[model samples]
Target: MAFRAYGEVQQRTAGPKEIELSLFRQITEALEAVAAVETPPLEAWADALYRNQQLWTIVATDLVNPDNTLPEETKRNLVSLSQFVRQCSNRVLAGNDGIADLIDINKSIIAGLSGIPVSTVTEEAA
Candidate 1:
């Protein structure tokens, strides 16, 4: 009975939205850590960027899955955004742009998932 209850708790904690939000938070923290250092070690930056890329890849894959319920247009938009993230991540790894935009993108997605208006959240963040 105790084990079953624990499993139920785990299921509740690992719902789709919770999982996505957690991933976003992790990416945000990793990006912030990289940004906090004037010259972050290549390994640390690479690890964080790779994780972010992996998360987006998974999101893209899920968006295209037949089981996914998102509208066709929404899936296309998300897939496009994921591709952009992949491109930007490569540039960031190559020392081109900063990670602020990537962080902002993840934050915006999280806000959308949480049912918060993006404009309001952006204003508050600013």
Candidate 2:
């Protein structure tokens, strides 16, 4: 989810509002991608690779852009990513984490959200 939110950000705007929106979208996408079921033979891995690459590109650019709407927010996201890069250490088939890092990214997103409170209790608690 974060990736999509980040992608929607339009740094070219007057106040970098567009870029902020993109960042928000990327955030949401990255967050949601976590729970999505991986259906083999359905190009799921490829899709994930494509999306992650896109997200990384935007994030990298934003990190260096002086016009970044929310510099602190961007940094926080990068820190989250950095943590994932370290925490996701493991073996892989073709230079990738295979499906392991997906879990890490999801966990990272949750960690990123740690400051936010979850106001509602779901059925599991009942």
Q: How high is each candidate's TM-score?
A: 0.84, 0.43
Per-residue lDDT over 12-87 for candidate 1, one digit per residue giving the tens place of the 0 to 100 score: 8798888788788878789879988999998988888989999999999999899999999999999999999999
**Clashes per model (N, Cα, C within 3 A):** 0, 28
Clashing pairs in 1: none
lDDT of 2 by residue, 2-87 (tens): 87765456343436444444444454354345435554433544554445555555666667677766668767778567445443
10 Cα displacement, candidate 1 (Å): 4.0
Candidate 2 Cα outliers beyond 4 Å, as residue runs:
1-39, 69-96, 110-126
Q: Candidate 1, which segments miss by more than 4 Å at Cα?
A: 1-12, 123-125
Please report, in order, the local distance difference test score of every candidate based on alpha carbons. 0.87, 0.48
